[model samples]
Target: MATEAPKRSRFKRTLITMFKVGLYGSLLGLIALVVAVGIAMSQLPTYQELVRRDNLGQMIRVRAADGSTLVSLGPSFGRWLTSDQIPEIMKKAMVAVEDRRFYYHPGVDPVGIARGIQVSFQKDDKVRGVSTISQQLARNIFLTSDRSYGRKVREGILALALERKFSKEQILELYLNRVYFGGGAYGIDAASRRFFGHSADTLSLAEAAIIAGLVKAPSNYSPTADAEAARSRASVVIELMRKNGEITGSEAFAAEPADVRIVPTPKQNSVRYFTDWVLPQLDTLIEENIEPIEVWTTLDPNMQRLADQVINANTPAGAQGALVALDRDGSIRAMVGGRDYVRSIYNRATQANRQPGSSFKLFVYLSALEFGYKPDSMVEDKPITIGSWSPRNNNRGFAGAVPLRQAFAQSINTVSVRLAQEVGFRTVADMAQRFGVTTKVSTHPSMALGSSEVRLIDMTRAFAAVAAKGVAVVPYGIRRVTTAEGELLYQHESDESRVLVAPHVAAQMTDLMQAAVLTGTGRAAQIGRPVAGKTGTTSSNKDGWFLGFSSGLTTGVWMGRDDNKAIPGLQGGRAPAQAFHDFMSRAVASRPVEQFETQVAPPDWAETEPDEEVWYDSPSNQGQMVDADGNPIAPPPAGEAPLTQTEDPRRPQQEETLEDLVERAIDPERRERPQVPPRPAERAPPPRDRGSAGDPVERRSPTPQP
Candidate 1:
């Protein structure tokens, strides 16, 4: 018994010695770990240096005259709210969904880490991360989204350092402001403005919960696009808040199924096309930096909405349309690029180059007026061929020797051809180009009947230039740009060049266009007010347009298929004219109604006539009027050798003009295209008295030709 007791005592002593050694070894190992962590922490960026880092990426905000935002181009948002400024419910939401034990954790959650490791090993799910809120902030601020081991280690280490340097509130604030909430929103304040149209401080409990749920897979949980998944996720968030004691069960239930309707930001609308257009201009105006700048634009939200409604409601199925409204100064007040911005982002208003049809006649007439043609000039609308191309008017009819004003009003194709041939085609093409037609013009007699393709915005601006009384006007949007602190950055300068059209010529053209509204093919645009405009329909009804001006505003509407298919019965005077009438009616509703200025005065040659013979044309007078220099204006006699028809004797069968095969060939139905020949109507008599074309007039029929 004594020997057994001695052996037990020895074993006990040996166990005590081994226990002491192990305890000391563990203490040494823990001390070594502490030293290693301290060294690592010292190697990181200094706390002050880290806090100084900033990324307030610019959100180029385009605003209207009323100080309301139209759209934000980059990193979109309003203001930054500190933790104190943020609502308590928003804070609770963040803590409940992101990290329940945020207050207790030093930097990393050991329990979460253990679970993550087990899940990774069991299911090989690398995405089941154990990143705490601080770690997430570290990743967002200083790291890429790469899933490398190096990134994770750096994230954890930075998280620990952040926790040591910042208090709990600071860490949470940093996390809230740095995390992305998807949909181009980068912070809590940005997300609040994006989905709710208010500041973060104004977020309701339901809004807070909805945004909280977006912390994981924001796009999938987007309430705007995927409301079902977003609501389900919000319900999960409310339940989590209840589980974490952040809210009561009643509160969770009340907020779970809340009907969330997002007050959409204007940035989501088709006006984004306008903003995109102006952003590149800003690039030249301002230096690139993180600070945001404000651009005061010429957008009228009311008019813009009206335009969008008109286009979306009026366009045919699977068809596209564009509208542009500009003031006399060439400020773009409203622009709708397409029917819907989501389906197609292309800005048809400024980018599309569709044929202008009869709308091109405006410049042709303007050029004729500039070259000393009176509004009362006479043109025979018979089948007068020009070269191989024999253009024919739509509807298979013609007026014999219609007054120039009547010819333009009726859109008599033969008359336009005669006029273009009388005044050099170069003069007409030059006039259109000067008035802002950018497309290459064919100068064929067909061009006089609107044969050139032009962007809607450019054509509208060209008309706006005329409304400005002959001063060339460039359409501008951004009026002024300012820094966030209200410091002047840049201001727009107007290029009001007056070299495009002559004053007398513009006045006369305006007079003739008003006659068009009174009795012309554009009768559909009658708005119970004096207006000046033109109608255009391309070959095959492929494009239709109405460009008009009212109350010092010019708006153009273009309709066509992106695939260039003919629209049945679509004509410039049909849908396009009516749509222009609707848009202008609303656009001018708030302004005082006024008549277009029709300042009629005698031409340079009218003063030469005596009182008794003033209205009489002398035998010495040629077909053309003289210029200010009194040089007797002479044009080649109107009847040129009747243009011979191009003949093809190969098998002795068919003959066609180049323009017939090329520009005007697509129309199987009557596209209302221009003419080379046509059935002649009874000759029209000269009017008893010709006045300025502001009001409609009746003319006696001329001597009929067999």
Candidate 2:
């Protein structure tokens, strides 16, 4: 029994030794933690800098190149200033509200901490904070927003070290600089400059007090953008000041007036017109961090006014429209995105995508021109069907036979569809693409009928290509940017590339478009000078588009609704054309203009008689001898359709079919006239019975005078 007792005693002694070791280890760990925290706290920056960074005393102003204010950043992002720069009342209010015993306490108040803990337990929330100026300064300078026990210990340690290293004034200054006011502002100096537009040293009582009020929450008390909210927050600060004995009841009452004069932010330049279109293009132009730049566009504000006037005068009351104009170098000069900038900031000129309607036929004719087809060539402007898709002329009947120029001038849909099919959809699409139509095109036959969407800027740029004689210039707004000292910072010129028929080919197209203005569908586009343009009136009158160009400028106008609903009784010729004319008259009022150049080369079949046979080259089969007599130089390829000869005694042997002829006429859809639908025929009244008596006196044909 005694041996067993001794063994138990040995176990007891081992247990005691283990307990002692554990206690010593824990003590060492606690000492290590204390020493680590002390080391971290000793490395804090000078308190003055922390105060300079946190004080809510700053203003930030943005300006246009012309020195006009565009916007102002206020106190939440404060400009730096010293404590003395602030009003005494403001300084006292902050101290009383944030930490009343700030001057007496080393860095923290035990009473405030106890009160905070008591309130936190009662409220079931961490709603009470007892952080003094020094503690706040320590947290802001070296810690994150974590609220763990470790963070609190670190904050306390740093606060003690801050008091040991700096005077109260210096600590207060550092505290002000290190606190975050909001809006990305780190210091009171930055905050002051951002909100009040002045240095911290020159602040007024109200301004300083209001800035001090932002300590609780910067966004909530942002004065420039949300004055009402700021006033509410300021009232809270005033109440706190009154309760803390920093201000008397009367003073608190006076501060409650909440009369804040918020600095007016500069207008957005609103860019109601082309700004939307211009924004996407700026990424490649400006450097990063250079923000809130004001672009003084080439928009002639007066011309924009005139455009608005004409559109309103002609358009239906509820209709919306857009107009874009570019100078000779393709610089956008003026644009009216819509009738009202406020009702809809969606820029119709740049955002709205609508069909071009008959206006798109220009590219078709341009393709035809490139394919050895002449403007005056004969084509049957009749009802036609391809693959069960039948298209009718605007007249709803066949013209039997008509000049290609005349057919296009009348905008005959049958002719356009048939011509598009024959001209090779690929070639026509290529022409459209080359002319600056960036939208994906419809590959079907109806594609020739303007079944594609295009923006005003793109359309205007395309027409500018015609004006520039085939050289397409990208439209740009920014010309130059310079520093305040006049050192050149940026200079931009047109990025140009050729995208269409040669100069002569472009001239032919311009001539045809001009004829459209003279006597065709675009008669409303006439501007007294040599002008080339096309008018597009979409089905159901949903969209009206007019794109035209003079010697030195190109303009595109569209009128429609925002909801895609059809505009009643609206045509491109009326509203859009008038808008175009008004803008052009003002745009070109002072500039000397040049006439459109004419085609220099004789078109492929220009001199050939209608009945004469002409040889043509095929893209696939080149230089292979096959005679008019049907003598095969080589046996026709197996499985191919046999080439048959037909005899036409009235003229020469007929080698091409009507389909082939139409195809040849449409190969390159360039035109000498803007195409329109044929005029429908009117029915004649049948002869009446009384006509029987008149029929007896039917006039006889006169004999040959010879």
Candidate 3:
């Protein structure tokens, strides 16, 4: 029994020893597992950060045609600036606040890390960072902006890698260049120039201090918007600079408030109007190695200014205006997109399509003239109601029976509608398209009165046809888009297509337009020189337009609101006409006069009846001078004396020489006065008695005039 008890005790002791061994082994395995996981957690973030840099943001630069940089788009809204240019005071202030031993640390500061560990346990806040400048840079440049344990572990690992790869000064310089200093400034150099308008090398003590203050929070210290807050933040930087020995206490105290002379950048007037219109045209002209070429347009700076001033002076507040000027050969000279371009970037002159209203009547007249209808063709201007649309005259009263010349000059709506119906709406719309007005013109009859919308550029092109004497010349701005070395990149070859109307027909139309200036609704656009144009006013006064051309230049003006709201009582002759007049007068200041073919009435025209009687109806009659059945009468007094139409002997005969005709046409105002075209020295006319052969001294007709 004693031997069995001894054996049992021995077995129990062995079993107890084996159990202790298993417990120690399990504990050792668990400790090893924890250490492995800790190391893995540190390395995972470093791998991820390297992968994230593949699509690092790129900066976009905008430059003028002259290769001057207008501005730049940066990653994280921060511009990268150089590090050597950073002010010493800003560098010292950063060191004082972020890490006192930044220069001594290799990625991680030992003292700072120990202190962070103590704080983490005592404060129970996982908020611990003993990062050196290199570590902070790695976090900003390579990692996501996440505050987590995993991120911190990876940040430290990556910082160690950076420290091993780059020197201490190199890491510091990278941090200074890559750190966000707010307002889109990435580096201290960019920040210094942005806030103080000077390079970091030239930064004053106060300026450097102010930029340093912005490092923590730029929004709180924006010198441009909040000067007082920026001053307070700068004071903090100055205090830190003194503590860090960057400056003495007395020097910091003596430093005045940063006289940060922030040079104001000029407003980015991107020439939105001209650019939008010219881009597509540019695309066609340019090919190969095409890296965003800058285009210097032919827009006259002075003309643009004048156009803006005239529009502002005439248009109502909040109203929009667009003006486009073109040289006679179809080169776009000046363009104003809107009254204030920055307020709205959608360029109206090029993009916005608006109703042309009565200004479109010129096309109608031209079409008629091309289709064998003369200016003297009689058309009744009465009330017209086609389908659901009813058009009324500007004066709200109709001319009973008017000639096409008088009707067009007065912009009579009833007469225009009648002409459209007679000549077919599709013909007019097709004619408009042939002249480069490519906007969708309605097939409806109302489109004859310009019910459809058209862009300012298209309208200008159509007018260029009139100015170019019946040629549809495509408008161009860059005469020759060339490289910096003046090698011809693209030459603006004139594509002049003969669209509608013969030269003589176009000349006749010009004559009628000239009459419009002398006595019609477009009288306001008349310059001292020979100018021909038409005025347009849409229904409900929605849009007002005046398109005209002098001897050398052609310009189109439009006035309206962006919302398309009505400006009641506004007419094309009011603001738009005046703006056109002012712009052209200034635009042609240096241009020499280019002579246009003048329209001369055939010798037989006097024998023919007047297109319509210019009846001076007494204002007392109230409505109109009408016969018993509401028919208009001849132009004469009621009873005292029906005035006799006298033929002036001073009028030069058509048999006169070409030089005499040229002189007469050159100075038309002289014709109205007591001046005559000088006779040839060899064949001078004899003096005539005023009373002899006053009735009809007619010569034989020169074959039948067309």
> CA lDDT of each candidate?
0.74, 0.66, 0.66
Which model, 2 or 3, shows the larger TM-score? 3
lDDT of 2: 0.66
Off by over 4 Å in 1: 1-56, 77-79, 85-88, 121-127, 202-205, 257-261, 264-267, 600-706
Candidate 3 local lDDT, 256-369, one digit each (tens): 765556545444453555655665575577775333233445665566557767766777666888888887778776777887767777787888899999888877777666
TM-score of each: 0.79, 0.64, 0.65
- Tell me how far the alpha carbon of residue 246 in candidate 1 is from the true structure, in angstroms, after superposition: 3.5
Q: Count clashing residue pairs in model 3.
A: 2
Give the per-residue lDDT of model 2 (tens digit) for 1-706: 8699999999999999999899999999779856865676567665444544323333333333344443444433444456666556757756865788899987768887788778878986563667888888777767876765567667777887778778887777666655666655566666666666666666555566677777777777777668777767767777777788777888777654266565554334333455555544546766642332344445555555567776667667788888888887777776778877767787877777888888888888877666545565666566676555677765677885676677667778887776676555666777788877888876666778888888878888888888887787677766654433355545776665655666656776777777777778777777777788888888889999889988688889999887778888788777788778877877677777677776556544433332212334579866353434323344346785434322223323322333543444344453212221111111111222214422212111100000
- Model 2 stretches with alpha carbons more than 4 Å out: 1-38, 41-116, 123-203, 223-225, 235-259, 264-353, 372-387, 390-415, 418-422, 475-493, 497-499, 512-532, 549-555, 558-563, 574-656, 659-706
TM-score of model 1 relative to the true fold?
0.79
Q: Which regions of candidate 3 deviate over 4 angstroms?
A: 1-90, 93-100, 109-132, 139-154, 175-198, 213-232, 269-306, 326-335, 341-343, 373-391, 396-406, 473-509, 551-553, 598-706
